[model samples]
Target: MFSIVGGHPALDLANTVAPRPPGAVEEEYLPDPEALVRWARLAGVIEADEPAEPSAAALADVLALRALIDPVLAGQQLDVLLRRWAAAIERSRLIPGPHGSATLHLGTDPALVIGDRLANALIDLVRNADLSRLRTCPLADGGCGWLFLDRSRNNSRRWCSMDDCGTHAKSRRLTERRRSRR
Candidate 1:
């Protein structure tokens, strides 16, 4: 299942690979080209009628792109990711839309179309999103393994959701505390 809590489609994609407990295999929601398309559709990045299947090369590119996104979200250097994103964006062309404003149009390549959409979302997030609100879920239960925009007034959100990671973490801590007292 895809985690859609990033508030941005790109961030959601970056979250596909989640942290795992020690000795546990890492969970990759986008394990292959078909999985990528399924996630893209689930995220509403592509329409149901549109093709979402990615080619092998495109799948590799998408995985590489996701790898670059992680560090950028963590406030790291942007050169590599920027260059990759630039190439993806280059695959698309901006043209006048029926509404009079420019619209990005992608070629028939399914993978290119998906990459372009994710690349645009990432660029927009970097340019317009509140960096201060970006946060990682801190639970040892691997949490939700997703990044989220903490729109809370205090910006103190620690888990992806109170019903999920938050509940798991609280229960874990309580269990730990009880064991310590015994």
Candidate 2:
């Protein structure tokens, strides 16, 4: 999903973002502004040597916030689109993970739980900001879903992986040509 990440560091400190898999448990949370204000307080939760499951009451508020990403699923994951990075680094590449789940961490240890924590922070970023000017991303998390990021240029950047989409589109064209010749 297109995650948005930008703000004046109040509740926008989404330092560790993570990619969600299809079957991953929902953390029993949704995400809401009011609850985010409260949820952000739990930033320390992920930081704990062994954090507890976020308060059930808080988890209820979080999960009730925005459980799905919209039309394709539930709703436009407003936070997903807004949870992007501020760095202008071009061409993001995938990093290997220990469990065979490719990961892209904003930190030295990609598998660390903090990455997910950072992503949650970015979620709060979008949840609290004005999104009238954000640009829509077609695919991210390897086509898991869509996301929205603030584009400084007029160019449209959808998926995070150009290698896959760019290369696959070309491959499809070649295959179609071979089949047509038969």
Candidate 3:
């Protein structure tokens, strides 16, 4: 199952591929076409009414885009990803929403629809997000290298969820301390 805690779709998408400790291959959630559609749905990129099937080409495109996203979140070069994202933005159009604001819509093609929404999220990240607050979950538990935005007022949020990784880490630290005293 997918964990949708990244606060932003772009961050969530980047987290589909997680970091592993040394000597381990990175964990990948979007392994095949079906998994890709599942993640898109979970990320709210594809709606229930939308076509979410994935093809060979679409899966390749999604993985490639994720590759570009990972380094950007890590504070690396943006030129390559930016250019690709700009082209994707061109393929979408902003129209009046049912509400007073505007919403972006892509073409009817499923691949373009998914890719464009992802591109829009990435573009929004570059333009609107505070890079300082975007960071990996700080749990020392090696398996979960997920990224999230520290939307806290102090920008000090560390774990993906205090109920999950935070509790595990705290319990682990407590056990270690007790053992050392023994």
Of the candidates numbered 1 and 2, which has the greater lDDT value? 1
Which candidate gets the maximum TM-score versus the true structure?
1
- Model 2: lDDT equals 0.38
Q: What is the TM-score of each predicted model, taking all chains together?
A: 0.82, 0.33, 0.82
Model 2: how far residue 33 lies from native, Å: 21
Q: Please report how far candidate 3 places residue 67 from its true position, in Å.
A: 1.2
- Give the per-residue lDDT digits (tens) of candidate 3, residues 1-182: 34787888887887786552222445688888888888898789889778866887878877777777767766676886777677777777789977689976764567767777787788788789887787776535633667788899987788877776677788988999999999
Q: In candidate 2, what are the lDDT values of residues 1-182, reduced to their tens digit?
A: 21223222222232112223332433322343344434444444233254333345544433332333322123365544344222211223468878887865332322323334444444544466445543322323223222344444655555433464435555766888999999
Give the runs in model 3 whose Cα sits over 4 Å from its true position.
20-23, 74-77, 94-103, 139-143
Query: What is the alpha-carbon RMSD of candidate 3 to the true structure?
Result: 3.1
Candidate 1 residue pairs in clash (backbone atoms < 3 Å):
none
Query: Candidate 3 clashing pairs?
Result: none
lDDT of each: 0.75, 0.38, 0.75
What is the lDDT for 114 in model 1?
82
